[model samples]
Target: MARSLLAGHRLQHELESAVDIVSRASRMAREIQKRYCDATQTVGDATTLAKADASPVTIADLAVQALILGELHMLFPEDRFVAEETSSSVQDERMEGAIRTWLTQYSTRGVDERVRDSIDLGSDAGGCRGRIWVLDPVDGTKGFLRNQQFCIALALLVDGLAELGVLGCPNLSAAQEAERIASGYTEGIEGEKCLTIVNGTDGCVFFAARGAGAYMQSLTDRREQALPQQIHVNANTDPSWAVMAESVESGHSSHSLTGKMIRILGIRQRLGVDSQCKYGLLSRGEACVFLRFPRPGYVENIWDHAAGTVVLTEAGGRVTDALGGELDFSHGRKLPNVRGIVATNGHMHPAVLAAVKHVLAEDVTSG
Candidate 1:
């Protein structure tokens, strides 16, 4: 049965609002991204928006968190949000000014006061509670900085499970997607551009409501004229035939171990992108395997995984920690109990899980 949103509100209404807020957030982010990279824009301008050590990408992260969380506060009113950025994290005036500028368009509250109070609305720590929204307003800062594949992810968690999810990826190519689906490698995109019907940039959005099924649509389309397509995990039972997805950043996982697992399983054709775009790839049947084995002692953040988990889960994919345990979200902001994450199309899970275990056993023996 499909789940209703907060207070018996239809899931459809919440889904609609979530999609709109995320869509607009995507537009805002990509536009900020474009301007950040513009040749005409002075380095000083980007410097002004930097977080620490002059990383300009922090601007987009702060801006998106502020707007989306603020909008969520307005629409849902009574719900809670656990988000990445907060008003206190705005350490510099440049960060504060940039966030305030974006909030100005949507907020009637004074810029400074709105900036402080509004962003704080997202700082709630989650629990097994009434309704909690998990948001990663900017899922991959590295990808966003380079104009590569970054995603904006949001989900509503009720009773410790993600009931609704939306992912906005503004860099993946639709034409390349079709070509790559046909042949693992397509004729390269010259100048590196995606064939997307762009709103602000070439991108796509994937969403799901539990039991209702997962779907994808163009990043820019409005509901009235949108061409949403239902999606599912690919039916590839053989690990040797799998196309795997992983993080683009080498530091994000223990690649050496993952490579051993892939080699043992005879899997080929790994596609790595930043952020939850990996989940979007899987839910749309583009890739079948994803692994995240962060360095020891680092607890996985819930905001990073909740949205993708629901989209993939509804699309017939299975997500769990490296040990094949369920990802429990009832605890708090960090998934302290989870060692790492592994997601795959359901058919390949057992085989993949065995390979992961085999590799871990070897790691223990070697250590």
Candidate 2:
């Protein structure tokens, strides 16, 4: 009897542990977004010079990452973190002093060192066998610099599968704002003076855990809504009529080749965006398909897709690697050891898979 009681308690504890990690990740993202809001006030504007990688690194990313790492440590100290950016980039003789001095103005004392090291973890390439946290402190660096869309993408991988993901999109407006922005109907905006879409004037956050459903929420307390209305992709199966989202930056993906395939399938409307916003859009039923087909042998880091994949899947979408293998985040820091990614509302997934298989077949025959 005592053994049975202990087993039940242990199972319950594990289940709660999963939920807590995912929930805290969402909270951490929200905290980071809030910190970004505060940092931008002091940084003047996000128009900083580019890094050697030609990517932008504003005070926003620095502050937010530090805040997130601190939160992760507080919430789950034992988990490993694999993130983007590193102290080395910030510490460059050309940039370190300026970066450090600038960060001091807005950040707490501890934040300086925390940001430096966490980013280094992002640059390092090891640790995937155990539980880990995959983080893209700021996924769309260019977008963030341009004052456009970007996301704080986070996911939790146990063993090798991603069991939870949380995405913070600070610029997204709520449903009410979305409607007003689309219709040009903003007589008395309720929330803060942020972007307004047809939905609402608040920022958007996406969260999902395996087995649990995906949900979206307004980052601000504008209308005090619960979250995004549960979303999924469109059901149209005719390939030609499909609409898809491709990386706005061609360098991040093989846009020309993806376009060729889109053209081949006769897909007409293609939307270009950054980060996991495509996944969020897909979940909301705004877009039906998203394709990230980079070079033939390119591998994607887990942070780029972990949260977005789980969110889309929980929302009733399907995501797979380019070769149609499952994207098992359980494997570690990188994804299921494959190239590229594809996500769609499940209705058109089979067709997409068939098309991809056909393309690979053609490539092989040509080879």
Candidate 3:
């Protein structure tokens, strides 16, 4: 009996270990976030570089990416990584200075070939296969630079599906703060510029596996004592009653198309947020639906929504391509097959699908 009990306990421990990986990722995100928040304490200030593509690269993005990659390498050695940054960004004299300075403050692990490769791998432009990790490092660079709502996004993909997702939204609050969360200020606090934790208090972290149900936690707290609340989509099919989340950055999605969809659905209020926090909101039942319809020819990356998909699914929500098919991440790095994605509380998913199809059909007829 004693041996059997020990074996059972060990089995439970392994099961919990998989769950603990989410916390480990979250912990790293928070640590990097703290460093980033500290380095950029001044508002309207930043260290910038011009990538070859001319897109802006800030110290905050570099520092945080380095921090996360360093931790990932240590934690999962055999795991492959598909990332967003390339070493070339750090090689440019202009970018090199910024990279060295920013990383100096945030990276306790000195830069090495592995770190360089991690950045380079992100810029590698290779397709995904087998088991791989996809990282946005920082999803909303503009938001991060502007000190608006941004997030560090990480996802683990296995056989083309996101098995795990971890999003660190530093600026969100758990407390009900009016219509929009104030910029620079987190939730729970009345008003303060200092760094505040929303995880245990008002801000939440969402996680889920394929079939294991979704769970939410306060960013600052990670105790198993409290059971995670399961969530489901609203059964209300009335489009007028729907509350939805939209992208704050128009470039990340198609605002015009989103507006049209919203109008068609007759949703009265449309909320905007940065990063995967939209998934967090949906999981908690704060919002009923979320949509990401990017421009034509631009495919959405798996890293951006993989983890969130599992979390929402586990929470009784449904996620799929805009055409109502399941998201397929296995083919390659970019989700090439799907043009858009729709996420909703399970109850409203079919209705949402019908509404989307109706609108598209009408557009075809009108054209």
Candidate 4:
């Protein structure tokens, strides 16, 4: 009985620590966003090089990874991490120096060598054995370059099951702020529908722990009355009335296939977005369905979806593979056992899964 009580206490402490660490990391990421968005810095300045798979890595990505890993190391020295970015991508001496400079700006104790090591610490191969922290420092680099939707996603897994998740959406408007502003405008104005504010500078931070539900709060510097408010998935069950959120890049997920599935499911509106912010939107009841059917031979990284999966599930939503299999994260960095992903508000998951299966099978036979 004593051991049980101690374990519970440890879990609570870890969850709280994770929330604080991710929030600080999010703030650092927003500073990078402001620099790029305001024309003070260019995309070329932030982008260093592409990975072997041709995905771009920017200064923000490497810097955020270093910041988060550095903090986690100080907080939980024994914990392991799996992240997307690596220091090797920053081959240019100037770029590497720039990253170190930003590290000092964001964190208090930034040792040059130690910070570089922290960025490389993400290469650890994670398994289902012990506590593993997963991170995608900058989930959608392209979207971020365009000053569009993106996120900094983080999650903690115990024995391969997600225990905690946090996401920072720098371009997302606070739901409460949105509603408050919307309330002031009269309904019958000429551009009333277009007047809705969808994005803001302060942005939002979403966090969730297993069985504790999900909550969102403002990601701002002001010491305002920022209390976490519970959020959930939309209650819409009818397919015809549902909206689908998908990736903006076709290569990430087959847009043609998604369109076909959307047609089959009779979903009327489709929102093309970037990064895990789609999951954030779904968790906050903005969208009813989120779909991603990667090309036939593509494998997904656990960091890309781990945080979003936990956040959505805790917000009364459901997540699964294209064939409705639970995502298996025990196989190191990549989700080798899972193929494509499908997320919804749990109301239309069955119908959506059936439609996905039917569409994919038809495509297979036709090809």
* Residue 2 C-alpha lDDT in model 3: 16
User: Which residue pairs in candidate 4 collide?
Assistant: none
Which candidate do you rate higher for lDDT, 2 or 3?
A: 2
- Candidate 4 lDDT over 1-367, as tens digits, reads 1122224644677666666666767777777766765433256554546689787677889888988888788778898999998777777777778777877776754544566788988988999989899999999887776666689999999988898888888778765424212322221222122112345767788888888788887777665634567889989988766768778677788767877887787775666678998898899998899999788888899999999999999999999998899887788999986767999999989999998999989998999
Give lDDT tens digits, candidate 3, residues 177-210: 3244333322222222212123223344455555
What order do candidates take by lDDT, descending?
Answer: 4, 1, 2, 3
Q: What is the lDDT of residue 217 in candidate 1?
A: 70
Which regions of candidate 1 fall more than 4 Å away from where they truly are?
1-9, 38-57, 92-94, 104-113, 174-201, 221-225
**Higher-ranked by TM-score: 1 or 4:** 4
Model 1 agreement with the true structure over 126-206: per-residue lDDT tens digits: 988779999998898766765666889999988777889999777654322543322222122122222211222446778
- Reference-based lDDT, each prediction: 0.74, 0.60, 0.59, 0.78
Question: Which candidate has the highest lDDT of all?
Answer: 4
Q: lDDT of candidate 1? A: 0.74
| Models ranked on TM-score | 4, 1, 3, 2
Candidate 2: Cα lDDT at 321: 78
Stretches of candidate 4 exceeding 4 Å from the true structure:
1-10, 37-42, 108-113, 176-198
User: What value does the lDDT take at residue 28 in candidate 2?
Assistant: 43
